[model samples]
Target: MIPSNKPFFDDTEIEYATASIQSGNIAGDGPFGRKLENKLSDYLECKHALLVNSCTSAIEISLFALGIGPGDEVICPSFGFVSVANAILQCGAKPVFAEIDYETMNLDPAHTEKQITTRTRAIILIHYAGMSCDLVSFSELKEKHGLYLIEDAAQALGSKLQGKALGTFGDSGCFSLHETKNLTCGEGGIFVTNDDNIAQQAEIIREKGTNRSSFLRREVQKYTWVGRGSSYILSDILAAVALAQFEKIEPILSSRTKIAEFYQNAFAPYNYITPPTIPDGCKPNWHLFALRINKLHRDIFLEKLKSKGIGASFHFVPLHSAPYSKTKLKGGNVSLPVTDRVASELIRIPIYPQLSNAEKESVVSSMEEVAEELGLE
Candidate 1:
């Protein structure tokens, strides 16, 4: 049976990983780790890139670096992964959930504006499925309100908007290199920023609130305890794997895009489901190929896929309506109609660079058969 997600790896990945082991520098920020930092900064075109342990840690550090602490609130979409909100909560801040645009499934700047209050200090924009949200509007909103813009670009390392990289558009951007992501290092992440101040602070925070980075650069005689911080560093072993993946980004992105396009063309004539949408000037990494089907038919459709030896699944449940959020939110229960609707209707198909042409065709064929059987066509 075809799985919903699988990591792609090659001989280069194994070779780099093995070399890292032989180098006897498996610690954090070693040679391979520094290489990854430089490579990612060059590729993302950001002034600074700090490798981290996980995307969750990347978000937490970004929040801490921006001074978003207790009594502050952050605006985020309820339709996204829970990490953004979890990061906010971890920093003793509140996450004010906002509505997402029905088409893009990204934070709607208009709705975001309404969610903002005096306590709101930042806005976390998540580029869902590696597709960018409306960058211009959010940038304007951040400036007008004097709020920090943090990008949860976990799925969008290679995605861009208006020819500019997605992560660079915000004050700080966090990216994941998890096994399931387009870019992988087994488990790792990156923190990016062009602002020198944020970059400096993030370095300290990532190194357990110490000035070790400065000491290493000869900027200081010795490192000392600094402010609030944590050990969010990614090891050289993982960095070695990530470096190999970075070198092959172009091919990985091309392979994924080819599959996505094939699926789009195959589903074009069917009104039974809607394919993924890409707004003008946006180039996605095709991290996920999600389709929208009738809410009523979603369950049976998933079951049919399973019976056909296909592993299909739905995306997130609206965070606002989650049992945990229902109890934690101060404002009783938040209402996000679009997020709720999309959560029930959306289904993600298997997508990975390693998927063969025949496997992709079979996935589409199985979906078509299921739709027909359900009288969706």
Candidate 2:
């Protein structure tokens, strides 16, 4: 059966991991971890990059570093991964759900600006499906309100706009290196920022509220408890694997881009489905190719793909409508019509760099047959 997601890896991953094991430093934040951190900083062209256990931890520490708490609220899209909003709740802050641009599946700047209130301390914009969001408008809104911007760039490691990286546009950017993501270390992530002060605070919070990072730098004679924090560091073993993947980022991104373009062109003739849209000046990493099918036929399309031994699936349930959000999220219930509609109609076919061309053709041909059988013409 063709899987919906599969991570790409090479022999280099095993080689580096073996080296890390023989080095006697399997703990977190060791030599390999430091090396990976520096590579990420240079790749993203950001001033600081901290390798963490997961994207969730990266975002949580980012919010904490910004001094967000209790009375403050963070606005994010309801159409994204739950972790985007969960990070805010973990900081004792509110998560205000915003609507999305149905075309790009990213946060809609107009709808987002409307969610802002006096309690809003930050706006977390997720680059849905690896496509850069409208950073121009969001930057304007951020400046107008004087609020912090955090980018959930988990799926957009190499995505950029006008030559600037997606994660660099915000105050703090979070990236995921999960097994299913474009790059992988089994499970890992990184937090990035340009501000030195925020970077220092992030290092402290990631180290469990201690000044250990400073001590390691020999800037301080001794390290002690500093503030609220957690052990968010990635294991050196995982960092070693991540380093190997980072070295081949270009090939991985290029392959995925080719697959997405293939699907886009193949599905364009079908009137019942719509391919993903990449806005002008945005270079996507092609993390996911989420096709919006006829709302009435979306469920059947998934089942048909599965019956044919292909793994096609839908993405997140709108967070606003989730039971947990109903009770936990402040400002009561919200009605994001666009978000709800897109969530129901969207379906992702098997997309990975390793998918063979014949396998890709099989996926598209299967969909075409299914579409005809369902009278979707």
Candidate 3:
């Protein structure tokens, strides 16, 4: 059976990782780690880039670095990954869940603005499926309200909008290098920023609240506990693997884009389903290829695809309705019509870089069969 996703790797990754291990420096922030950070910074054209253990860690560290803590509220899409809300909560802040735009499955800028309040310190923009949200609108809101804009760009490593990288638009951008992402190092993440102070604070926070990064540069004679922080750094071995994967990003993105285009063309004639929509001037990495089907048919459609040896699945379960959020977060139980609708109707098909042409055909054919069986549209 085709799996929902798979990490694409080869001998190059193994060689790099082996070399890192043989070098006797498997610890965090080592040579390979520095190399990966530098590469990411150059690619994104950001002033600073720091490697962390996970995107969740990157978000939490960024929050702390930006001074978002107790009594502060962060506005985010309720239809996104739980990490966004969890990270805000970890920093002693409240998560004010907002709505999402059905077309892109991203936060609705207008609804997000409505969620803002005096206590709101930050707006976390998640680039859903590597498709950008309305950055212009969100940026305007940020300027108007004097709030911080943090990008949860976990799936947007190669995505760009209006000729600029997606992650660099915000004050702090966090990316995931999980096995399922286009680029992988088993499990790692990156934190990037253009602000000098945020970069310094992020380094300190990532190093467990110490000035070790400064000492490493010989700028400081000794490093000690200076502030609140955590051990959020990534290992050199993983960084080595990540570096290898990073070098192959263009090909990986190219492969995924082809698959996404194929799916879009295959399903365009089917009135029963709606394929992902890309806004003008937005260049996506095609991290995920999702279709919006009838809410009543989504579950059975996934089951049918699985039975046909095709890996298809539903996406997020809107955070506002989650048991934890409903009970723990204030205003979390509030109504978000768009978020609810999209969560129920959305279905993600296999679109990884390693998916073969035959596998892609099988997925499309199986979906067609399922739609026919269900008498869809």
TM-score of model 3 vs. true structure: 0.99
lDDT of 3 at 282: 98
Local distance difference test scores for all models: 0.91, 0.91, 0.92
**lDDT string, candidate 1, 1-377, tens digits:** 99988888889989999999999999887888888899888888889999999999999999999999999999998888889989999999998999999899999999999988999999999999999999999999999999999999999989999878888999999999998999899889999999999999999999999988888788999999987799999989999999999988999999999989999999999998878889679999999999999899998989989998888999898888888888868862688899989999999999988888888988999988887788778
Q: Model 3: residues >4 Å from true position, as ranges?
A: none
| C-alpha lDDT (0 to 100) for residue 233 of candidate 2 | 86
lDDT of 2 by residue, 282-375 (tens): 9999888888987888999999999999999998898999989788655637999999999999999999988999999999999989988988
The C-alpha RMSD of each candidate to the native structure, in angstroms, is 1.0, 1.0, 0.9
TM-score of each: 0.98, 0.98, 0.99
Off by over 4 Å in 1: none
Clashing pairs in 1: none
